[model samples]
Target: MSETLSGQATSTISAVVGRADVLIVGGGLSGAMLAAQLLRLPGRRRILIVEPRAELGRGEAYSATELGHTLNGNAARMSVDPDNADDLTQWLEAFIAKGGWPESDQQHVPVSELFPPRGIFGLYVQQRLAEAREQGAVSGSTAEHVCGEAVDLHIDSSGARLTLADGQCLEGAYAVLATGMFPAARTRQKHSSGLNAAAIDPWDVAAMSRLDPQGTVLIIGSGLTMVDAVVSLEQAGHRGPIRVFSRHGLLPHVRRQPPAWEDFLAADQSIRSPRQLLREVRRQCAAALASGIDWQAPLDTVRAHIGRLWSQASDVQRRQFVRHVRPWWESHHHRSPPLSAELVERLYKEGRLTIEAASLKGLDEPRDGRVSISIRPRGESRARTVTGEALINSTGIEYDWRRVDRPLPQQLLARGLIRPGPLALGIAADPGGAVVDAEGDVSTRLFAMGPPLRGMWWESTAVTDVASQAKALAVRLAQLMDSQKGRG
Candidate 1:
């Protein structure tokens, strides 16, 4: 083992600890894609990925064991490679040609347009990682997967020291935080007297299965997560009336294969505020509709420029946007797959599903194994009660790091190693994904990517954005490593 000091910091050396040139803290899609991209670089570097799960590349979103859960986007747009946008489509073609997937499961959609199950996508990611590893082996680069959870990180001038849940320590010259989506934080109950056990996790299919099949079910939030919950119930032979409640009661619109439109905002430097941007977008949508084109085409054009617009907006403008326009924007922009939307519509038409615009008041603890919920309907002064056999919280991923209950985040915050990003949405990081420390210094040895970058880029969670970030970060890290090697 060797140790070197840079500036005021000194790195301790321990010969027994595992070591790698680059260490990734999460083995989800973000970390796996980064590792894959790094392996393609022309250097022989040791890479270590620390993930508690037995499988890599399948995080909370894509690791769904339920068949009803599917990708929100089509195959053509979900490629892990930014340059090769149709790579997933090509992969799906090959997958379908092999005839291993059931014909009925295809849902009669074209291979390029199919929204495959999340589990299948997870497998594709794993396969890509494996291929990258094999290719790296021929070039002398090596990648190792460590099945462990990274609990804490200690950094010095030379590098970082990562402590795992299993009492193992790993040393690396560089560390990347690729931890993906966090679980939804518990909603603040108005009255906490007896509502402790009244809530159920939206993703817990097993808990959902235990509910009375014919009893009423209450789902909070009418987004994609709530759609997933409803699908799970349907797949489990549930015939109950489902009630979905949200502030806007806005369900995600169905995705369409719209033709590409001219990106008017791409060259417009004057659009900074949310109101200006929204106005321009509406005008473009109106023009597109007049021309017999889908409004989604113009929306897609706007989506391409969201990051730039967001970065240019002032903090106050951003807050205003979040408060006044985020809900409508999210519902229209981040849409559900066609099949999922069809399922939801069919259920609503059959009177099995009801969407309500309301604010949850509180839950009156379980009574006779059922819970009574208080809700105030939109434009109403009086609150009404609804009883359900089960209540599922589908409010979506928690963005505030301060509210996250994870040990790693808690430790990082307590030690002043990291600070919350804009609006406390996620961790603060530069555009290159290098994490900014509490002292406001950007760390060369520490970096981050994926969902943690939501504060930096509003569109960071999708596969396209993530894959592009991973590729760019990999190139940056590889160049940095090469420079250090030359100095050594």
Candidate 2:
């Protein structure tokens, strides 16, 4: 169910079929992690997870049916346990021994370096949640899966009341806005560019298969998503030219298992501004290359300090970073898996994939069973029309809450319950994921995590980051509940 927030207290509990101590608005990895953390705590708080999907833990990111769609991070770096870094590696090793993933041997890499399929990752998440559920059951802390969409939310001094699409209401002492990222291709838009209506989904290999096998494909945006589309095309037997367009036509750097370099950022305490950070990074890269080390080693070490650095930087510095460094930052930081990168490179070398430094102007009406789009090449004065047999909008995830054409985000903004994050990246929230309203007041009963905390924690979407946040947030919630118990 989808819900928009209302400021006034129409908080009626009538017809409420469900009541929980914690109401988790999303059942994706973030919600599942929160539930697991809450269950682990020494308390008996009831948790109700509201999600429309039939299965939990598999959000938009992991709901891939294609094995070609693999997680960007390898197992070692993607562990959900903060203290136990090799948790996923240990689980995967046992699972592979039991003939779970027969294709595991093809990677030929150590279990820690093998990037699992997104679907399999979702399965791993579900298994962890199940284990947590059993522990919770023994502790008398219950977790229920409410299979429905939330449409309306009302908050009062006592608690929050949520209304679902089926007219059923659910109440809870606290609510979490754990809704995940909204991919541009799948999400509806308030003001659209007609790209989504004409473009095919990035993961839909079946739809790509129906297209002319030898016809050209037009792809907008060149990032990890673009890499996925290229892989999808090859898997669907597409042999025609693939034209990729973006403002800055930079492909993601291939992820590598590079030897560890010294943690330069940790050793330096003066790196606060984006400029200083970039300069230091360049120096570290030069030093690493001079020492015959991969540049990625130094950059990878900076991942741990990103939230601290980004949050501490002034707004001017942030804008400067966005204007001057965002393109390079994204391309360098969000790297592609080796196999997918190899395919993209092979197709490009084979004269089948052409990348253009251009910006999409708009869409032209389809003519002769082909998709037409207007694009102005970089540094060009005029826009030209290009047509292809198929078009895929691989732009990436939509981060701005105000621009998200969803019922909940729209209502949240309308009601001033949440404000846009710095530079409108995502919704604004305090350090602990307490939502900040338009009037600059932090929310106590309402909190958020995961991708919704993009602005609060720049790298909050990563598996490790989400796990740490869940642990901290769960501890905070337990403290709040304990205080309430003391008062009662």
Candidate 3:
């Protein structure tokens, strides 16, 4: 096994290569939005999106079948256009008005509310692409959606080469890596038992919903996913008690009714280190508490500048920040929907929900039907056991793409086509999302964005932030493709 980030290649590169003006590697929200933005370009550029999944926009976040899985952020904040403040709302309203649904401009909506399902969100995004095509956004420009996984990328002087899992290859002047969250870590306890099945990843909602409603369901993590699961279970008429366990045992804070102090983090200088940044944030948090402003206000400020702050930090500083402050920061910034918050509170008040701060020891499968889970306290040597019918590991996604079990990233690293960022944040790429080579050089064609750049740009996950990146990347890729065609 290669211990280093980059390694020598023993395998031969693929020979059956095709070409395109632009090749987007993932068809999730970021990739689709980038494709939409590309349609706005003047010339006809053949755009190809390599998405292994059959559906687009229904990434891990929007792919849930549960109607109770509402967006944590407001609909107004999820617009593809950062410039257009009411893009999603306008679209949603038009859609709702056409469907003759009740119209209210309320900020927060419940998970039970009959708004657009995530699959519908996928349809809306795909429809936008179709509308763009009909409007001559890319006149005579062909847009192909190939259902395949891009396993390897080959960067050269001419362009970048993409190797699909089926041995089909695609070459493009530019590429976007928008692979969202990967599957979470599977529990070691489940490895031995053949009967007890559980979902450790957010994307595996079907498996999660299979748990008995009368039996106790244990959620391994307490964050957005936990809250989402609670809403889903309740909607499914799951009257059983829900138990959530984590190190901190703190649920995510909720979004306020009216957004307050939108410009709190607009500081004079954006070059502060992580320590200084945390100090300043605490100061603002204290001030917000004193001034009757919600703590989320000042936290949002820090989030806005997280990219700049992360970029400015040294490798050591970034590692320290991740080790010491990431969880607390995430709990504050990535909040739950107000409705979900209320549901969790209601569950707790009714004794249907219990939060624990003990360390999970292991899983014990008894001769009986139930599964007993062992847990030990932080400071105690004694381990206590709880028997539950099911366990759901809502411990979020594996953010580190290098650790991803897929073959493409591994092949790319072997070929020196891409390198990871400092502090293993994500794949190393230039500011424009161009993939950097192993020799510490930016490739002319290969690019990446979304959570893959979390190391470089810490705040790229939210729709508000990613939309800008997508727009900018699309504009640049369009220009690059046009320039290449002009030369050809």
Candidate 4:
């Protein structure tokens, strides 16, 4: 009895109806996009997409209530079209034509500009997905969307069966897992003291809504999440000081204006280990700066070929980079909106914002209802305590599911269907994103995409990267299903 958002259970009629040609387990951006691509194919096929969320397109990344939450990339670079480079721009134009935005805000902005409102992109994705669903209806193939969590997967020589949480079962020739980012649980470290309430996980809307207007908020990490926290606080009328603490104490750089375009790093040159790739990025960043342009030009170059770059890396090199270099790489590669960064810098200069290089040591709850945090600086042995009216974790989403310490993963691990990646970095998978089983062999039908496969591919988080992977995976599935049908 799998259930939809309405809590209406779906009976075990799928098997009787015949298995879906493809069953997608997570209906976030990747899963939704993949479904759209499959429906666009020129053949009749039954597809079922299983997602627990009531909302479809937003998922974890794009779902945001605040207007301040914008996309990390600009509209031009965020297009869904693999063919038309200006797809997002065209999409925006069409949206504006439909009277979707204010005329004053309709200035021509380059796609390379880092747009900060993720809700806008979420709306775009929803519109596109809805259109695709209509297209699917017109075609011979039919798509059924199930609102339920896929709790278990059983696979044999014939096909794969998915067991939903409510006990409804769905059998499909193929399935793809697109579980997005899951944030790490707050630690009991000293630095987190007085910060428990301040810790605002990205997914917690209730927590964010409880923020006090005049409270001094301490953010745990400095990244895109921190950027989001800052913007959200401002929107929430937080006038007090906001502090961001992290190991590197480095915030993401802002996108430069008049977007610099350099095709220096060819797509083929992207194939290399993480170390080699980091060196290439460094060289390119330096070259861009030397040539009197901002460092973002090189990053844009890298994003164009990130999938190939990750696919080519050896597993050992991939692990090494995740451990030693991921934090720094993330700050530079996933940047913030220029205006937002400027606001943060202004807050810093005005003494309303402070970024500290330290690890959280403790969190103390005050009787008066405030939290106190203890932090030990990177080098000094001495610890310091800072009291904030509020503490927002803003540490960003954690990909390492092992840290989630959830029952489902534990159960799956025992069943030998899935394994944690190197150091529990992310869900383990092969280059093509087929989940590695407990016995260390790649499962044939169980596939995963998006941030869940971060361990397998170091650069798998962003929408552009994930969309490309989803499209490629759709092609593979189409080919695989076609071959199977031919055999039958």
Q: Rank candidates, lDDT, best first.
A: 2, 1, 4, 3
Order of candidates by TM-score, top first?
A: 2, 1, 4, 3
The RMSD of every model to the true structure, in order and in angstroms, is: 5.0, 3.8, 6.5, 3.7
On lDDT, the leading prediction is 2
2 versus 4: better lDDT goes to? 2
lDDT of 2 by residue, 1-488 (tens): 22222212224433333568999998999999999899988988888888888888888887887788888889998888888999999989998999988998998999999998889888888888889988988879877777767777777788888877766688999999889998898888756677798889988898999988889999999999999999889899899999999999999999998888888788987988888989999999999999899999999999999999889887888888888888998999999988899999999899999999999999999999889999999999999999999999989888998888887788778878889998888889899988898899988888999998887667888788889999999999899989998999
Residues 258-313, candidate 4: write the lDDT tens digits.
Answer: 35666666844644776777777788778878888777777777666655556566
Task: Report the number of the highest-TM-score candidate.
Answer: 2
* Candidate 2 TM-score versus the reference: 0.96
User: In angstroms, what RMSD does candidate 3 have relative to the true structure?
Assistant: 6.5
List, residue by residue over 1-488, the lDDT tens digit for candidate 1: 12111112213212433578899989889988999999988989888888877788998878887766888888988999888988988887888677745652547777778888888889889889989988888888877777667888988899989887755678999999999878552444323333434667666778778778899999888988888888888877778899999989899999999998988887787888899988988999999999999999989878778887777677898898898889988899989988778889999999999999998888765678787889999999999888888888777777788876677887888877788888887898888999988999888899999999888877788888889999999999999999999999
lDDT of each: 0.83, 0.87, 0.70, 0.72
Q: How do the predictions measure up, each by TM-score?
A: 0.93, 0.96, 0.86, 0.88
Q: Global lDDT for candidate 4? A: 0.72
Q: Which stretch of 10 consecutive residues in model 1 shows the poorest summed lDDT?
A: 1-10
RMSD of 4: 3.7
